[model samples]
Target: VGVERTFPVHTPVIDEIKIITRGDVRRAKLYYLRELRGKKAKIKEKRDIRPGAKAAPAAKAAPAAPSEA
Candidate 1:
């Protein structure tokens, strides 16, 4: 049997996010094996940030040419 549960996690980069954890019921105990691993991988990828790094600036649009009547 399988069970699913929702957990709220707070992080600096993501603020707060709800993660659904799944596990298998064995011997009346829930064993969460894959859910934790997957969550860790996802959070690692998202939280990969360098300190003192700046984001690239967006390009500005060119001014439209004056319409000649």
Candidate 2:
């Protein structure tokens, strides 16, 4: 998770495996899974620390002015 690797999944020709999901891992590895299982194997759910991260801001919305006859 936190650690970066060079030869872990190195490819010389082209392709290898397909990643299904990219987890928001807190630690370098999920080594705790060896002993823990079921409920204990679960990691704490991570939340967005960024403000207004749910959606992107509207495209610079401006106040419309009333037209005169």
Candidate 3:
């Protein structure tokens, strides 16, 4: 996050300033993530959206059945 650069308004900088992520953020800022690390740095997952959208269940698969003794 230690990025520093400058761009003139006359240039085509729309793509650079645009919001690439369309997340439904409940909070206005995520500056706290900078202070966290690794898994702790992860933010709450948001359901993906599209024309035919579907929200995947957040569950882990059960372990396979043990073989017969």
Candidate 4:
């Protein structure tokens, strides 16, 4: 009985490396933007008097009855 193992190999190709680097940079930028947005949201919540609370609806006045001529 014999055990066989297979290992994946990557070629030292310049184009492939450049493509992989671009993908890494794009992912990093997306992650940074997401984190920044989350921090801004937290800051905004802190500034709010009631976080996650809904604003009270404005009271609407009923129309006055027309005056008889």
lDDT of 2 by residue, 18-37 (tens): 75445566779776766765
True-structure Cα RMSD, model 3: 13.5
Q: Ten consecutive residues with minimal summed lDDT in candidate 2? A: 53-62
Which predicted model would earn the best lDDT? 2
When summed lDDT is taken over every stretch of 10 residues in candidate 1, the lowest stretch is 39-48
Q: Give the TM-score comparing model 2 with the true structure, all chains together.
A: 0.39
Q: Please rank every candidate by TM-score, starting with the best.
A: 2, 3, 1, 4
lDDT of each: 0.45, 0.63, 0.60, 0.38
After superposition, candidate 4 runs with Cα above 4 Å error:
1-60
Regions more than 4 Å wrong, model 1 = 1-10, 25-69
Q: Which scores greater on TM-score, model 1 or model 2?
A: 2
Could you give the C-alpha RMSD of every candidate to the true structure, in order shown?
14.3, 10.5, 13.5, 21.5
Scored by Cα lDDT, where does model 3 land? 0.60
Clash count, candidate 3: 0
Error of 4 at 4 (Å): 55
Off by over 4 Å in 3: 1-11, 14-25, 49-51, 54-69
- What clash count goes with each model? 0, 0, 0, 0
lDDT of 4: 0.38
My TM-score estimates for the predictions, one after another, are 0.16, 0.39, 0.38, 0.16
